[model samples]
Target: MVTIAKANAELWVFPLSGPTGGSGITAVDVIVVDIEDSDGRAGTGFSYVLGGGGATVAAAARDMLERFVAGQETVPPQALWRRLAGSLNRLGRGYGYLAIAAIDVATWDLHAKRLDMPLYSALGGVARTLPVYGSGGFGPTQDPDAAVARSLEYAGMGCTAVKLRVAGAPADLDRIRAVADALPDGVDIMADANEKCDLARAQWLVNALADVNALWLEEPLPAHDTNGFATLAANSPVPIATGEHHQGVVELVPLMQARAVSVVQPDLAMMGGITESLRVAHVAEHYNLVVSPHFLPALFIHVAGAAPSIRWMEDFPLLEPLFDNPVGMDADGNISPPDTPGHGIQWAHGARQEYRIAE
Candidate 1:
């Protein structure tokens, strides 16, 4: 059996061209991990923050590797994950899961590479092509024209659907209307409030989107407000979408049980890793809810293969620009898993030199 020989992690910060709407993401925080087995075979994985706290997450990642993962013999991926999760039992959620996600992903990459299989196939080869939705526009600074222009950009790339942000401003509905009107025939629209709205305003936003026939209203209420979501789900004209900030099944089970949302979005970093995210997808399936994981389409493409519940891949390449060879979109506006042996992400030749955070 291949035993883990060494593990190390680093933090990389890349500035975003602009903010990510209400979240105000001015930069991306990337926590990168590298693991090697006795034979010198290696794998890499990473996690990120949108705006801040990257350094803290990076430190947490280093701590996890040095303390819990360094000497552990390579075991089944799930077994190692449980060890890590159990270690974090006392620390609560949030940071612990985010930190472990990078390491867990790195371990999975090693596992897949050692087995000589593509990561997606190793997970469960459902379909090679995962349908994608254009996921930008509606940032804090975007005006109605900019929002429409962004939607058109995604449509130009052959995406069938696009997501926009709704900042709860009085002008949001009008902005949504203008953007929706600008879309070509057959294109669909989705809106995200980025947790910027309360129940009353969320309800209003949902009501206003009726004229646009939006596919879903995402994160209109804070993720913790299960009751608020239930209320909205019960009466709002649009289907509710949330869970990107969720840690794992603990948070998701309640949301599902409460019938909080029709589409459950699991963020890879926040959910721990692919293993936990798959658990979330299975749980979502049990509740007859659809899985539309937030961002990281490259990684989630494999997830789409394993979990039949996932219907759309979000094409928000926030960290992808740092990769030498990121996933690409097919002419059909779908993404296919790389036949490469692991998760198939590599830093661009100068990425580390360019974006690595100085100590």
Candidate 2:
């Protein structure tokens, strides 16, 4: 029987070229959790903080390992996930969930490794190939020509779809026009506002993008604005998608039931690991809403294998910089599940030495 022998957490910060979306992409904070069992097996998981608070997340992760996981006998992953959530009921989905995400993911990785099975197959292996979309085109930094070039770059790579960030201004219509006009034939375009718009602004965008033939508009209103999203959905020429920032399935259910969103996007870290992510996907399937998880296609590829409702896997490459063997897409714009056991993430040589904060 494998029991948790040791667990620790550390912080890794990486600087970006420029601002990404509205988050001001100066640097990213990563909380890394390393777990080991009595038998000497190991697992690693991490969460991303767009701007700051890496210390808090890392501390919380360490606390979780010491308080609940260390010395515990390995058990069914779903049971461990529940125990972890119950242990931190008071935190109410704050930084603690981020910690829970990393630990729970590590537990699953350990479990999959113990069984010598690829995580995708362990998750149920519903599909071998998941379609992908190139994600970029930040506004205020990437001008129309630059955005167009980026879109074409993805298109040239055989990507069927590409998503660009909307500036959420009256002039955004012009930017969309310029990019839309330059897109190659048969390539689909999508827009993301990153919750930068109010109801009126979202409506204006919906109306302005009437002729762009965008596949969808993401987070036009804030994630919590279900009423506004419902209102927009009633009038939108394009489908609406949201939920990356939602705390859990509770926040997402209303949006799906109200027909407020056509696509449901959940970040694994924000959604609290594979257990909850699969739960969300099953719920979306019940409601007939498309599930497209936000970021980390490499990890979410396993979820796609298990959840048939996951329509597309996004190729954001947010964490690729840190991995020596990052997942890649095929010439046909599709990605296959990793054949290796566990999540198949190979950290770059000396990554922890280079990025880990010295204690």
The deviation in Å at residue 268 for candidate 1 is 1.0
lDDT of 1 by residue, 145-179 (tens): 98888889888898999888886778887778888
CA lDDT, candidate 2, residue 45: 85
**Residue 316: error of model 2 in Å?**
1.8
lDDT of 2 by residue, 273-318 (tens): 8888889999999999899999888888888888889989888767
The models' CA-based lDDT, in order, is 0.86, 0.83
Residue pairs with backbone atoms closer than 3 Å in model 1 (clashes): 324-348
How far is each candidate from the true structure, as Cα RMSD in Å? 1.3, 1.4
- Cα error, residue 291 of model 1, in Å, equals 0.8
Alpha-carbon runs more than 4 Å astray in model 1 = none
Residue 36 Cα positional deviation in candidate 2, in Å, after optimal superposition = 1.6
